[model samples]
Target: MEQITFSQLKKNLKKDTTGFKEIKLAVLGNCATQLLSHALRGYAYELKIALNVFDADYDQLEPQTLDPNSELFTFEPNYILIQLCSEKFQLEFCDLSPEEQESFADRVMARIQEYWRRVEARTKAPILQFDFIEIDDGVFGNFGLKTQKSFLYQIRKLNMLFSEAASKDKQVFPIALNSLSAQVGRDTFFDPQLFYIAKMPIQVDFLPQIAKRVFDTVEALVGHFRKCAVLDLDNTLWGGVVGDDGMEGIRIGELKDGKIYSDLQRYFKALRNRGILLAVCSKNEYDAAIRPFREHPEMVLREDDFVMFVANWEDKASNIRRIRETLNIGMDSIVFIDDNPFERNAVRSQIADLTVPELPPEPEKYLDFLRKSNLFETVSVSGEDAKRTQQYREEAQRTESAATFASYDEYLQSLEMVAEAKPFDSFHFARIAQLTQRSNQFNLRTIRYTESDIKSISEDDHFITLYFTLKDKFGDHGLISVVVLEKRDNGTLFINEFLMSCRVLKRGMEEFIINKIVNTAKENGFTLVEGEYIKTQKNAMVANLYTQHGFTDRGNGIFHADPNTYIFTPNFIQEN
Candidate 1:
């Protein structure tokens, strides 16, 4: 792949906008960031995400953050990239004694915590903080790991502190600058001449790579990250076809050719643990395809690991569609990996939105390419993520049960549905933020919020934030719906955001929540409730949500409902 040159990026920035989905991104750093803005915009165009880059004044992060009326807040950025210069950051603490360095690191973390607290309190946008660059000490070369006071050791410790801070604070996302530097070779990535002349620490050549990393995070933040990875079985997952070669003939164990396949299975299993749905879409007999997983002792993945195992003599495109429908996700959310070029092209032709990566002819390059490609980037993960496979399996079971029932309503009722509505708390914060970032189709108003934003709303007296969790006879659907009601006045309430997971659609969940809204309004002194539905290309399914839920359409997608006139009953959903 040809890297985007700085000159090319500058030239591309002059082109007219293609009008992709717009995202406000602010870049703030001690190092020169003008080049990064152009490079990010150039790369983001490929992802169909229009990057509206706001280049903050060089080294003005403190002033921009401390001043409430600063341009950083005024710009209303969706993501703020804070790149910490290695020289500026490491020079202060590198010369200190071991004990002093520990104290200094704590103080630095405290300062960062304060900065985050102030910024988070002011804005809802999440901060993308870049960790310190790796700078080795000349004097303490080999002993740097043992010497805590050395520049190399202190910088490493600082990175750890940054990671810890980010883990605790949901709004702070740490970017591994050192890791990127290591990947591209430190000597090539750092430009000392440019650093002295233009105050640009990252080389002009590396700016594009840096920009790509930032955009990948932005992509994940806006919910473009893929959720499912569909794998082929025959030559893709193993050495040979199980049906033709038999279970004994298939290469999948500790042998030379089979070891790489086992390694690939391990990689997919790890992805499954991270909540990416693993699936099998193969052209073979079901029994033959599954026998390896069931009987092969060296196989790293078991039959239970995959959420959907589609083993049949069917077109790859159709099988992929079945996987998508079974998983209840968009076609774009599924990634199909196959060794056969014909199958890949066929699937790509049928599902235009599907991500069919061009596999390397060699299996050794598979894991590295997939990892570096950043197809499954994620901003956050919750406990519910680990249970994704089981959740989908339960959804599949529900689908099967729906077929057995005579009517849809009968199937819904027979499941004995229940919903628990509550305000956002520590336990529910992560999931609520995930839904805000992930939900697209059933989302009304199309507003995205970070965990800090949800926290602020939950604590504010004027906002009524509610998260609803659905449960049926099959299993529990954890924290699937979020409704944020802003009290405009004593007499009226405005729906600031109303988003629900698409998995709970057509289950009377909407009606159940509407009833809760009415009951809550009556309990309080509010007499009128209004809602606004902002149309996005993906959210057309919910364009008529407000009108359907008893809200009067007042021109231009605005809706108003009088609480007294609203009639709702919790007939199907048992409120908990």
Candidate 2:
């Protein structure tokens, strides 16, 4: 395989935003070998990953070069890539007698294995490590008639050893095989056994593609999150401004230019379906902008498709602020998309954290632009994504109703708030887990549990996993909040895990849940409701949730809410 230059590999690594933490490579050759060394250095610079290049060419070094008393082998790397070639293999038998060759090879293997064992023991600082085996013509030249069989046996043995080692060490040991010569073929000299031995192919021409696949695989194994794209209406949803062009005049249909806008809408809809929160921020009359969505025949997006809508002449920055505040998400989590460059630039300038993509002049390029921006690329989508828009819409309605109420209690009363808390089952486990993962603000413990972990909680009687669906006069906010409660033996209800969707924050959802907990505790004869405020980078909004709900601080990061002092409106349940 042709080798990649250090500069080229570095450039690609820098561009690789695939979110891999570390790159560990093992080179089994002269440490000074320019190509591999350069590639390793480049990767370190580009990916910002810790590079661990192992010098495997023991034969090339002077005898007893890495003495046990020396410091050559003391340094440890996050990843260890072993470049195993015939040249390095010769080092094992260089000073050995004919009868000692087998013993020497065994001893060498044992040492390498032991080193890996130590590396695996240090798992607190996990490292991505791999080995690269180079197939060169020297192996065939040295073994001559037995070259094929010997090479096959060695490869198989090495694979088995690595696989066993990986399982024992709990470290990923991927072996990348590179065939330098083109003379070998499957029918002529190639061995099917090699297929099982090699984990990744070393193709010269498709190195970039291969690297990208590896990066993607690693990211999928880990997980990644990016900003959500908040779309706009009028020229954004279709081709023309709905307020000026009227519903029928908006270019969105199956014909010519209209098809382009339709396609763009379809693209946006697909993105929405994949958990990207779709919100409309159009500078037009509410009814006028929403009319095309309701009455237009060619419209792909409906009124229910959006999470939030800001249809007014107010500054878009203000509307965006409202959306962010209501959602309880940071300004950085949003991406504003508008057809007008001025609007896009305005939001971009005002909200430095908000990501605003340049609007394409032609509708046909909308999808392409979105793809290139990579704003919504993620590892997985939880069920919470599907109902995100509905949740936001419900919050918007709650905000509107709050304006009409005289006092906070009156607003809470008017909400007709119903907090439908249910034990998490298979149907909602995924969403519950997702909320734990993505929800930042309003998260109590900020303990991110996976779906499987949540599912396993059912077996424990002391642990309670419950999710809440809030609905009022405006709409049903599907699965707005989740609370995983743990029962302690001291007659206390411990708030183990608590998270609320950004859409439902400040809508009396938390208050309603607290009231329910208090009532439940009172009925069940519990003394106090205890909670903890686990600090996180994003959940400062709810740092005082327990205190706000009348929880008294009990030092050492613990708070207690008195069940007796809690006041509840008798009609809270009847109204819902």
Candidate 3:
């Protein structure tokens, strides 16, 4: 089979990111061609994967280049690929007597095996092992039946070697073919279609395809993931500024100039559907900026579509900082998209790691640019993503209502919040773990666990994981909080983990959940509700939650909240 073409290689490499610490590659020379070498170099850029390519030649030649630190080893690669080419070559030959032929074969084969073992010992990085094309007489010329049989035998041996390597621990098989029908004479034996369909290994048919796959794989591996997409109001989501054009005069809807902005809004809607968190960071009067969202006829995105909105006349960077703080996500996880270049640059300068895309002046290219960037390609999404925007909108309304009350307790009472706590089952395990990993500000313990851990907890009756979905007059905050409690023998509810989405903070959600836990403990004949506060860089907001709930500081980052002393009353609505 021929090597993959350049275009196909590029396409495949763009599939993901490569941040792997160590990578091993085995190269077999079919001809005196450097095409594979050039391809490897190009792929390194696309995948961002650091690989040490070992080049081994089947035919002996004088050593031209050698570097102890270089990833490429020519002699060793040649021996390994040649030894695996035929069964006539014995593994014992690697330790045979020093006859001229035996010594040459033994030296090459032994060095390859030794180098591979040594490198494997040196690092824990994943290895991608490749087998060079094993060309025989039947592949090169119009050979008779015997020649074709021999050729098939060589190919079978190569396939076996690839299969064996793949079976080894942490070894990846990357099958690369130059073309679909490059060797037409040998088409009967080498079925390219079968290889592609069976997926025997991660195959790259052409150069462009290989490049693209490498890029994609490396991008995913890097894990430089971004979460929130912060948008600017006026000339961003819609065409014109609400302050200048008024609600009706804004360039939005099906009108001639409005279609572009309307389409842009639809694009954001699609992103939201895919679980990309949306927030607004604008320097406009809150009322004016929100007017179109509340009243515009053709607007697809409403106030409920944003997880957070900083619509005051604050500096753009400051507004972004506030959103980041409110959401409790890293600034690096945020992508600030604004129409104004100045605002974008300002955010880029102020927030060291924040991603600010250069906005195209023409409205038609905005969607295309974002699609090409692929900045929001996350690994997985949980139910929390879908409900996050609505939860934040509810939070904004709650904050506004809270201002009218004189005290925090009075405001919480006016809302009449009820937190329905149910034990986590299979349906909520993934979401629970996701909340634990993502929630920051109100996460008391901030101990992130995987889905498997959550599943294990569900299996054990001692562990009670409950998620709280809060709803009141404002709106429904779907699955806003989760608390994991472990029941001890002494009838005390030990809060193993507690996390509330930043969107639901300051809304009595935490207090309400704590009250529910206490009530559950009292009903179960438990004596006390205990919890711990683990110090983290991000969870300072929740460090004092135990104290607020009448939990006495018990030293060593532990607290004991007295159930009898806890007094929680809903002001706006009654418990269900």
Among these predicted structures, which one has the highest TM-score? 1
Model 2, which residues run further than 4 Å from truth?
1-228, 232-235, 240-249, 273-275, 283-291, 311-315, 339-343, 358-362, 372-374, 377-385, 486-494, 506-508, 515-530, 561-571, 574-576
Please state the error at residue 135 of candidate 1 in Å: 2.2
**Decreasing lDDT order of the candidates:** 1, 3, 2
TM-score of 1: 0.93
Task: Please count the clashing residue pairs in each candidate, in the order shown.
Answer: 0, 6, 56
Query: What is candidate 1's lDDT per residue for 89-108, written digit by digit as tens?
Result: 66666566668875665677
lDDT of 2 by residue, 292-360 (tens): 788888888887888777799999999989877766677766888888888887887888878777756
Superposed model 1: Cα runs more than 4 Å off:
1-8, 68-74, 90-104
Q: lDDT of each structure?
A: 0.84, 0.61, 0.62
The lowest-lDDT stretch of 10 consecutive residues in candidate 3 is 78-87
Better of 1 and 2 by lDDT: 1
- Whole-model lDDT for model 3 versus the true structure? 0.62
